[model samples]
Target: MLKFTAEHEWLKLEDGVATVGITSHAAEQLGDLVFVELPEVGAELTKDGNAATVESVKAASDVYCPLDGEVAEINQAIVDDPSIVNSDPQGAGWFFKLKLKNASDANALLDEAAYKDLIA
Candidate 1:
């Protein structure tokens, strides 16, 4: 299932690992992305912890971990081409993957409908 955080990050769980990214609303608000700093693979992360940083022409934003987990992977494409984040924040622009400490934490996250309501 895919879930969203109040901060505008999205999480999509598949095969036990959860893929995470910023929502398009966040990207739109940030303006053009200039840089992205991702968490190290294998690093332990806490729920709601600062996991990454994204800098745009407008401002710098922190990407928080929605749930506790270990970093399994991060998207290199966005590092190479930050504009990908502006172009596809929820698809090719995904930030990282996590081996969740507790999969049930996803239940606490907002669903797409709720997230849309928030960004609206």
Candidate 2:
């Protein structure tokens, strides 16, 4: 399932893990990315906590954790070439995999329609 936060983070959940990334809207707003810093594997993250950093030609922004979890894996591709985020923020640009503290907590987040309304 896919869920989104008001902060513009998106999560794709399967089993107990969520792949997290900045939304396309966020990527567009940030412009072309120049750098990305991801959390260490095994780091515990709280909902809404800063989980990663992305710097663009325009500005730098925090990629917030949309739910409480431990970092299971980090995507090093985006760090190696941050522009990948601009090209595919919701796909190849994903920042990390999180092992959710409570998988059910994802149900409380926004759905696609609500997130579109929020960004509207």
Candidate 3:
């Protein structure tokens, strides 16, 4: 499942890796996606810090790191085709994975249920 931030990001944890993305609500709010700034693999990130950027026709927004960790991988394909974030925000549209500087960080995020409530 996924967790949400008050800043409108989404996080999904699986097999100890956290997959991050912007929520559908966020994508819709941002309008048409134009570009994506992805962190390089192995880049160290500070929790809640600026990790990347997402640009839409309307504006550019920062995507917070959400956790303190090294970036395990990034979806280069999505950077080339930002529209995927609008069509599949949680699936093929996933942004990056943080290898995790601290496993307990995931515990601080809201769960699927709470995230749903947050958006609603």
Candidate 4:
């Protein structure tokens, strides 16, 4: 299942790892993404810490880590083509995957409805 942080990072859990990305709301807010800097595999990430960065025509935004974990993988495709983030924020646009240090954190993340409330 996919869960979201108030900061706009989304985590999609599968097996034991969580795939992370910026939500469509965030992409929309940023305007048109022109660059994306993704976390490296094996990097340690803290909850609420900056894990990635996205630059749009309007502004640059830091993408925060929604949970504490070690980065397991990243989408090199985004780095090669940043606009994919704005085009598909939730799917092919995923930034990275983390090997969660605490699975319980996933339970605590917001669902789609709560995310809508936050964005609204």
Candidate topping TM-score:
2
Q: Give the TM-score of candidate 3.
A: 0.92
* Candidate 3: Cα lDDT at 41: 94
Model 1 earns a TM-score of 0.96
Q: 19-88 in candidate 2: lDDT tens per residue?
A: 9998999999999999999999999999878899888776788888888999999999999999999999
TM-scores of the models, in the order given: 0.96, 0.97, 0.92, 0.95
The residue-level lDDT of candidate 4 at 30 comes to 89
lDDT of 3 by residue, 15-107 (tens): 677888888888888888999999999999998899989998778899898878889999997899999999988788889998887777788
Q: Per TM-score, what order, best first?
A: 2, 1, 4, 3
lDDT of 4 at 56: 82
Which of the two, 1 or 3, has more lDDT? Answer: 1
Please report the TM-score between candidate 4 and the true structure: 0.95
Task: Report lDDT (CA) for all predictions.
Answer: 0.92, 0.93, 0.85, 0.90
Error of 2 at 24 (Å): 0.7
Number of residue pairs clashing in candidate 3, backbone atoms closer than 3 angstroms, sequence gap of 3 or more or interchain: 0
Clashing pairs in 3: none
How many residue pairs clash in each candidate at the backbone level?
0, 0, 0, 0
